[model samples]
Target chain A: MVKTQIRFGILGCAKVGRKMCRALELAPNTTLYAIGSRSIETASRFSSENFLPSSVKLYGSYEAVLDDPEVDAVYMPLPASLHLKWAVLAAEKKKHVLLEKPGASNVSELEKILDACESNGVQFMDATMFMHHPRTLKMEEFLDGERFGRLQYVFSSFSYKASPEFLESDIRMKPDLTAQGAVGDLGWYCIRAILWANNYQLPKTVVANRNPSLNKSGVILSCGSSFYWEDGRVANFYCSYLTDITMDITALGSNGSIRLHDFVVPFQENEAQYFQACNSKFINLSTGCEPARSGELVRADLPQEALMVQEFANLVANKADGLKVGKKWADICRKTQVIVDAVYNSIVRGFEPVEIMS
Target chain B: MVKTQIRFGILGCAKVGRKMCRALELAPNTTLYAIGSRSIETASRFSSENFLPSSVKLYGSYEAVLDDPEVDAVYMPLPASLHLKWAVLAAEKKKHVLLEKPGASNVSELEKILDACESNGVQFMDATMFMHHPRTLKMEEFLDGERFGRLQYVFSSFSYKASPEFLESDIRMKPDLTAQGAVGDLGWYCIRAILWANNYQLPKTVVANRNPSLNKSGVILSCGSSFYWEDGRVANFYCSYLTDITMDITALGSNGSIRLHDFVVPFQENEAQYFQACNSKFINLSTGCEPARSGELVRADLPQEALMVQEFANLVANKADGLKVGKKWADICRKTQVIVDAVYNSIVRGFEPVEIMS
Candidate 1:
């Protein structure tokens, strides 16, 4: 018999995990089964603060949560450095893995986790919630349709100003914990958006900008890159921990263009919108364009994170019903990781062009 | 005696010159004094088609317009390669020069034109009309105020898909006429927007993207570049003649961000708008941002082009009153040309970093 609801065990008390806990509650096919922290007191505190059901289990260690027979999946929101070990262990324990973004320090480490998931016959997905938003689907339709011809250029930016305390104590500022720094934390989304715009085709080359803002520990706080394809297609992205909040993507095609100011997180929870212009041309006398860009609004039945949880759980349920593991999410995660690795490598090589191996 | 109205002469019957002809008529302190082309028949045809006043003069050669004592300023919409010859001649004849962009083939040629203007006591300005739009002034206020902290990053894109006939015949595709091609035609606006956001401070280095689409004549059809400054400020821009019409600029600062889609040409001629978010932060639970971007609309008393003509006329009128030639427009044009040269140089050197000399 197939399980109707997937039981999710969250393995960290990170601030992002609080949002995921709420997502788990909202997803129809997912339940918050367990909360785990290094100390039982922390787990209990998180459970009480989030108002988890009394039936929810509390554990002092991630290993205990992974060992629980009733937990069908694990949501790991740990630091980037810990992803490979815990994500691999969760997959080895036959639990579906919904790991947080910046999936691993590098693609090599991420591959190890993917290998374990394949051997364990479990689902593996990175929690890029924005990908699950209905607005993304609407934009994809425009990109793939005839109105928007071949994609030629894409530009994305993701940034937020960090407070003084965040700069001093956030895990992202530490070289050992989030080694990729702003590139891993904020750039992951920008890179993913670029890859998505290009139908997951990796760029021919990547070159990071030279003037990266680095902390005293040499961690990148801000950086950008230009991506090039063999077909003369180009993409660029800027990510920073030192600028005001901005999430934008502008994708242009031979005949159309699409722009969205809030690609990562919509301003509102229930609805999101994007602007598109097809065959826009200047009017007579070049006073203005003939057809102004039109905004398309998409309504979401559930929050983006909740929809992500539902999607992950549906895959896990199908796997439990004797179906083969779906590879789509894994493939998408790998592509995003490869670009992230290439960007980091380019930065390391003094802003030299780094060809994508794939 | 100081002239109360600046009489404008236009060189070349190029398509853009038609727009400026209309602008001269609309500007309060300017008049369409003369229309010049390679042939008198062509100039007469343009004058009749554009419905010029019966009092306007027609000239068979650009030099004829410069020699006309009644013409106080000349708007030269000649090809990029011809600017060096015609702009210098116009200035030598004591005609204030409002040259269409890209001002010249390179800074070396532009400097010669500027030198002639300064020695002749005549004003020099590029016809980048958007710079004079009231909306730009409003956006500048936001960028210069305390609401937006130090500018850290700027990204701009300007592209338009050209028809097959255009690719085959347009001067922008001919290296002899517009050697810079898309870089000069479209990228000029993007580079100008970047420099405008940064207060005309030239970036320290510019590196072109590796994949630049080139025409058969070796003219750039599409290209992009990443700019780096010593203070960790960065800017990137993409320009193309092979994509849909898109004009965008997103400038991010430490405390605020501003975005506008129609930066080059407003959607409507009468009014323009931009979006800004100051001190925006994610609300509790990270569900959504607390302050959404607010759109600021600016109404134009005259079209941007007309305002540009009026501003140029005012400068010339002041010069006629024995005031020194204003150096601000000249300085702006020189800085923009410097970056344009650097971007082309970087592309020529196989996507290598090219440093700005001044």
Candidate 2:
């Protein structure tokens, strides 16, 4: 039988890479073919530690993975500063790219990688796994349905308390590696949530909250931003490495509202839940509310990461079969990066209101 | 038997006044001594509608209720513009005052009312009924305990869609009657919740979100504000008259989080609930979290409003027995008003960051 599954090569053996490796194995339309690390010994150790099948290849350098004609795609989990270089190189080699979040150091660097993908006619997507979750699809329906009326306010928060060792030495806290720090690493999810709730409509202005917590190296450890639209819509988000693990999203409409506690990742892999209240009102004498909020549970056939991987593989397959390259994922990634850049700009400019240009 | 119960007089027949009338009847330490409206017929109608006992006196004017020597305290449900005048008059007449919220139009006006209450040696408390809920006490304990660790962030929202008639004719939308509009009406509760979560420690600065929805008369219909503290604590709140009814508070600490959907009023009058997650963490591969959040239910023997009235009556009785006036409620009321004032000032100043004075 002729093999039809897309072959995936992973560049780097970072901690997050292990999850993607599992996802590639779980996705139905993808095969985990190769993993490349700076050293062959490191790649070999990662493959064994993760119990990857011996059939999978181990390459000593990222260039070797791109050089292999059998590798159809690459999942890059390199640090943010290196994304521009390796992502462009992978695209130049005509390989589909699934880049980890904080897609690049800034929007300018991200644009370069995007241009390379566009020219090479290969698919490009950031590894925002939640976007592929079935719960997210249900939430989008609720926001679009009449029961929810029109979206007016959105608030999201994503934070996790980092250990003392991680804070002191993690690449995320190093200015040279991840200059955007918490805003890029965590606020990326929050900003994506806000934009998703609004159906990708960019806010007119972005203003950073005053007094974000920063480390000795001047990397943001905790931060937040307020967003305003021309139609009186408003949103705000907070992301931190100094608070408890919490991923929450509350979207309030004109007539209803929806709330989720674990938006970025579910409490469980197979099932996720969200609470919705439609036409809720105060009862007589304003003593209490009518129609208590109802929780909706959504079950997933595959974990969200696997679903994301499958979706990316399908898009790549469709393109190979003469379909137009999918621009949806790329568009979403660019919008998220724009807002992330604006937040950083606002912080650098003393928390001024940074006007977003489109 | 000698009369020991404090006698209460209600100063208006507003919609909210109906709730307080029920509260006064439910409180064991108070008596519904009298009700005053614009006219004797109106007062009589209100008394009948609320099923007040015949022994409750009916007065044609507010001054008549204040002049009644047997009336120990006054619950004023008048509009925001009238609170300063009526509340000060009630206090000057030796009647303890339970003023409805927004407390007054601004902090300056509230200060004047506070001064009158202090000079007359009468107890003063705002009708923020949620503060009296047992659930609030429990939540506070969690916030202050070691499990929750130090507070880092707070987000609150209160909103309700108003009918066309209300938008056109309600005193709350009139500039003269309630100039602060939705910020004063709905934002009051959100600000109070944030302040309460932080133990009434004021933020260092407050900045209003741009483009607040306003009526033709320039009364705010929707608005939000971001608050910052010197120690990197941050909070943001949104309030509106154009969205579905929602009262939510999410307080995040270093190690735990507490969230309540109906923070302003319970979904059920007899019991209130909140959710808390302590020491939650992502499990292996970040597929799921460990120790899911837990829900806590607190039963109330009396409704929150009734509890508020009873607490105020007890303070009045203590003062009557030569105990010094209780200052805690007054202090909280003042702190809430200062933040409220700062929010309005920031809006007026084009969303500038207004420094808050402690």
Candidate 3:
């Protein structure tokens, strides 16, 4: 029996799509089967610039990619507004959906898309590449250990200074194209991180910080939110399109603390460093080694994004029980969307705390 | 024609006093003149343990040390409850006061102590040694530079896991001794860090996190607060006596970000590291570092506490200009107290936002 390769079709020519195309090529179990754009010239240009294999097919419309019987999966990197339409159609076409995140306009819309994926029995996963990194799994193991004790507080930040040109013309800054703005762009990862730390426990309430900057279109350029759990566990996150690039996650537990400077994306493609300390305290002589520093360096055999594609493809190619939807991932995506909505609601209500309804 | 050395007296045999005694010895313009404990036996034991100079005097009572004409300055490491009484008496007795933090129960009590110090013309300084570190001056220079641009957000945390014995019997856990508890101990450093980042601009509002762990005596063990400025600048601090040692200060400015893992006390006594990024942003290829990375390692010529002793001694020894008080330090101490009070008030009022009066 020959090994089966999941053929993935590319949707749109977004900057992120360029990275996804390379990821598909790098993923051993996935092949770049097709490319789709509004115009064939644009599709051709993307394929050329990305150096796509000549065997890859090109189409002028996303519908053509979904229609191709050879394509087992469609990777959608469209704008947030377009995700609801394209993702549902891809799922309806019985193709696996590897959708870029801010999965939908909101939780309700994401629920609808998830419904389609569930009904169609197609594997669904978000393109949150960092989640697939070995480092993330290692950190989770540490967090689950007794040495770290009970986790109490978490802080995550993801921000980057968008160029003036991007701020002026990028689809992310257009209210109609991406209604959630930076909330959906950067906050998605931050919320996902908080939930991941808590074993995907949703917070009871969320309050946005009061210092969000908005573009002329009333799109968020920068924002933050604080989340509170029933057990007095707290998490806050900051995201921006107007600061130096930063991705941090700091978790404080009863007996230890874990810190990572680069969480959304590792500083390097293959390795990442995180700091953890257990039973830390200052000893005699006013010097502290109780938080004896442990710099954990996690190395990945493949780049995280490639690993993400490979993982998604593995689910799609799992013929033991035929292809089935990754229901937990869809649930996780919906929970993340709910939090994004809660933060947006709080910001809309002038920074008032909003209860998150499960 | 003789360069008059400021004679120092240490009150109480608290663990911190051990460090202060060494600082006084290291300071070029200061000499350990006396040590006062309730019993001469205890004072003599402390002197012997600390390897003090043979010329140092021992006093059985704090009042006797204050009464000694040669004791030009008194380093008060007594409990918070005694600060109001002994600090005022030390000032009234013409001895400069180097008081440990949480100088008093509240701002009102600290105000009285400050008033006495000002009226008596005796120098005053808190033993927040990090403030006197040469690295602090360097950080300030970076904050002042155009490259760092405008400061917008600050996060500070200071925490350490206290031994079980300390939790049960330390003066810090006793309401009658240090009423503010963790808010007075670790939180003092956190608040000072925020103020230092903002150039001492007090926030308009303070809101404590809902989940503060309180001891049986109603003294705080762990707490956090968020402070908001009118111009949308925000700061937050987390402090605990129930977690591993962690001291971090991260300041995000318009053009850059500055972060130090060891802010309250340097990881090493002689040198410390801080990371800063100016004009940072993400570029093409999905990898970051546009702001680039700069790791600044600062070396201290003398320990921070020794510098604090020397600075305080300089003011006290300026007899040619009629020995004057370090008035600015007194004001800083007062402002820190006001913020601490605001956090405590907010926590007490069900986590409601409290306005900082000053």
Ranking by TM-score: 1, 2, 3
A143-230 in candidate 3: lDDT tens per residue? 9989888888887888777888999999998999899999999999999999999989999989787778899889998888888898
* The best candidate in terms of TM-score: 1
Interface RMSD for each of the candidates: 0.8, 1.1, 1.8
Q: How do all the candidates rank in terms of lDDT, highest first?
A: 2, 1, 3
Candidate 2 chain A: 10-residue stretch with minimal lDDT: A1-10
Kindly list the per-residue Cα lDDT of model 1 for residues A190-295, writing each as its tens digit.
9999999999999989988889999999999999888988888899999998888999999999989999999999988999989999998888877888578888
Structural similarity to truth (TM-score) of each candidate: 0.99, 0.98, 0.96
Q: What DockQ, between 0 and 1, does each candidate earn?
A: 0.84, 0.79, 0.57
Task: State which candidate, 1 or 3, has the greater DockQ.
Answer: 1
- Compared with the real two-chain complex, what DockQ does model 3 have? 0.57
Place model 1 in a CAPRI quality band: high
- Give the clashing residue pairs of candidate 1, or none: none
RMSD of each: 1.0, 1.4, 2.1
Scored against the true structure, residue B9 in model 2 reaches a CA lDDT of 93
Candidate 3 segments exceeding 4 Å error: A1-3, A319-326, B1-4, B319-326
The models' CA-based lDDT, in order, is 0.91, 0.92, 0.86
Candidate number with the higher TM-score (2 or 3):
2
Error of 3 at A29 (Å): 1.0
